[model samples]
Target: MGDETTHIEQAGPTELRDPLVRTEIKRAAVWIGMTLAVLAVIVLAQPLLLILGGLVFASILDGGTRLLGRVLPIGRGWRLAIVTLAAVAFIVGTIWLAGVQLSGQAAAFSATVTAQANSMLAWAGTHGFTPGEVQMDQIGQQLMGGLGRLTSAVSSALGAITSLFMIMIIGLFIAVEPRLYERGVAWMLPLRSRDRFYRTTSRMGYTLRRLMAGRLIGMAVEGVGTWFLLWLGGVPMAALLGLLTGILAFLPNIGAIISGVLIILVGFSAGVDAGLWAIAVYVIVQMVDGYLIVPYVARKTVDLAPALVLGAQLLFGALFGILGLALADPIIAMAKAALQQNADERSGGKAAAEP
Candidate 1:
């Protein structure tokens, strides 16, 4: 018995294995596994990005179904089918109408862009801010090189028709049965937590719907308004620029800057007066969106922080290209909602009181 007691003393505390050593080992293993998983995701980011794109489309369809239900008294299936058909028809009509004009103006657009760039360079030279044609040449080379890289990256990852088909199919399936997927996810959670999970998902859906509505309204307003004003102002490539602006408008801050720059540049290519008119048109369109459309939509949904959205855009853009950048705001909004719910739960629903 004395020997056994001595042996026990020498053995020390195996209890530490359960409370400390085992826990530490488990933690280390989890961290390592997470790191590997993240690395794998980064490597396979293209497919993941495609999946995310499908989710965005699904959200749009889901939102449309809900909206149509309010007015049409139709089943989800009929509503979804109607919305999808209408969307397809709209796209086809737009393309058919613009196809000839866009093709014809393509060369003129390129020439105008080049002229504006050279003019900008010359202006910079006159201001003593540029070293003349050498700097201009360098800038052109850099721009071309960057574009080449971007094109290569995009083509390599998403050039396949198969990818687009896959994305569309995924989105169609998800939209067809959003509730099934939502319930499945909730079912995976503990029974006590499932309500919270469902609530979070519903909140996220509402937020996304509002966000997308705002985006679509902004895009339509900007595109139509810009096209009309630019055409009236006799700016070259009015249709193309307007279409570009409308699509880019979906990206918020960065989109505005890009569209503004393109408009100003193309406007300048025509004349100084045209440039001023383009600026005026831009200001008017943006003012209307800012004061009217955005406020109305924001009242219905969560207002995202500009910096957070921009950061997500940059990070996602680097990882997954244009699709990531385009979807960044919605993704961030959804994530923010989820995180807020988690925080509220962790704080015993007292987080709502703190600030």
Candidate 2:
């Protein structure tokens, strides 16, 4: 043993024992770790997205609970319970009251949309825009085929009651005692990073709450306003259109374009006047949301650029499907908040160092 120790001492430090080499090794490890992280995210995209969906849901519940606290003077648990129960009741009541009617309208709406598409194609052909009958038939077939595939995929995945139930359960567990999870995550981080992590998470949570508040409010206003106005104007499937519009509102730019197309198509089926009226309603609702709700939300939260959000939506949707599309806004907002906080810290550090 003494001879071995003597031999080791005489042999001197190895590469890993050298300080510079150790530092380089650490740097390489970091790069490797980052590469692995990226790979993991790609491979586990679906489960990660589901977890994110749960977090988003928790943010909504947390926001509602806080809002109720201002008025109800109740315990957090009680407030959360109230909010959850209210949401469940609203969903159940809406379905119970209008399920059959809406189902019938949905089928009719699909037929109406197809008929309108054929009518448009026919009109275009008459105007000498496309004279080939075979081409028109092919185009129509392709459009219908794409729509069928999209509808089937969405119904099978996004409409899965089990997925939604799992999300709600996850959200409730997190919302019940969020700090526990927050601290648990922080515990996994290095001591020096925990404070920064906490700050970033706090900012993210605040941004999410404000962003969701605006989105929910906008959805309610647009849905109800569209329904009431369209119904008053004798538009068929007003309820279904309004419902679609409200849900789509959650998706920002893409949602608006889709809902508008549906509204215009359905509106024209009734008459030219009704079609024009639908356009007017769409304009008014959008104007209210864009000028009012968006600006108010921007002031309180991170104001994401439209193009950036759209790009993120497209990327996420393509990568992770519908849930990613629905979540792109919130994810972008949280990322923005974290980045902004990091910038602030760096600026502050520079300022401190300058003196």
Candidate 3:
């Protein structure tokens, strides 16, 4: 009985020694590892996203620092400090100057939007829409509830000041000595992979820098242009609209839609002429951005498809909320750069191996 038990144990190892059995075991291990990885990602999604946000913020700061370096001819640290301080000063000054105006306008803007929405619903009802009063009430309630949930979730995840502070600190540290972190990450990888990893990362960084530069330029142009044109046309809440437009411009398709809707609603609240002017301003601004800014930027950076970016934005927004929405483009651009680098490497290797 003892010998039989020993034989059975030995048989297992003997089977494992066979090439086919070994391959099967390896496959099973891979599957198990992948499943575990997925589970871990699900559990740690928030922390992972925050880290990614930090990286994105770091990239923006790094980009500015590099740009400043060209003209300033100063140390990177000093340049970075100047850039950071300038950003802080701008925010503080803006708030100090227009805090009260913005606060009042924000409240009025909310009321105007609500009134316009009700007006539209009434107009639709007059056109003989089929929905009953109960259904309409339920829809309105559901929409408000959904918005409440979304806002609450975003606030909790962001933790407002705390999350912002953490992200800024993380960004500052990484920006201060990015190479240290890079090397640290590379050290954890297999020796053979370090070179490829470095190469891929280099590509990703270059793409990100270029992409962010274009986006910054686009935001500035759209924001400033919209503000000036709307103000010239005597549009109400020009400053608020401009600020919102500029911030939203950071987001792409959805941002434009949202800002445009706000502009139109506010414009109509004033008068028909104001509304028409608002429409004209929106059209002109979008045209400039879409035709001139976007094409130029696409040429310099990764030429992402609109559909692909929108799809990613939706997916990331659903999974990770507003932060994810903000980050979707950068993440996609980096991923594309990495994939391209990998494909190039594979092609080069194949070419080298051919007779």
Which has the greatest TM-score? Answer: 3
Question: What's the lDDT for all of these models?
Answer: 0.78, 0.83, 0.81
lDDT (Cα, 0-100) at 242 in candidate 1: 90
Clashing pairs in 1: none
> Where's the lowest-lDDT run of ten residues in candidate 2?
146-155
Kindly give the stretch of ten consecutive residues in candidate 1 with the minimal lDDT sum. 144-153
lDDT of 3 at 204: 83
| Model 1 global lDDT (CA atoms, 0 to 1) | 0.78
Model 3 agreement with the true structure over 1-355: per-residue lDDT tens digits: 3455433444455586778789888999999999999999867766777788788778888989998988999899999999888766765565554566698888888788777766766777777773533333556677445432333335663474465666777888888999999999999999999988888888888788788888888899988999999999999989888988988998989889889988898888899999999999999999999999999988877899999999898887776667777889999999998888888898885111100
Give residue 78's error in model 1 in angstroms: 0.8
Which residue pairs collide, candidate 3? none
Which is better, 1 or 3, measured by lDDT? 3
Error of 2 at 284 (Å): 0.8
Model 2: per-residue Cα lDDT at residue 355: 5
For each predicted model, how many residue pairs clash, with residues at least 3 apart or on different chains? 0, 0, 0
Error in Å for residue 184 of model 2: 0.4
TM-score order, best first, reads 3, 2, 1
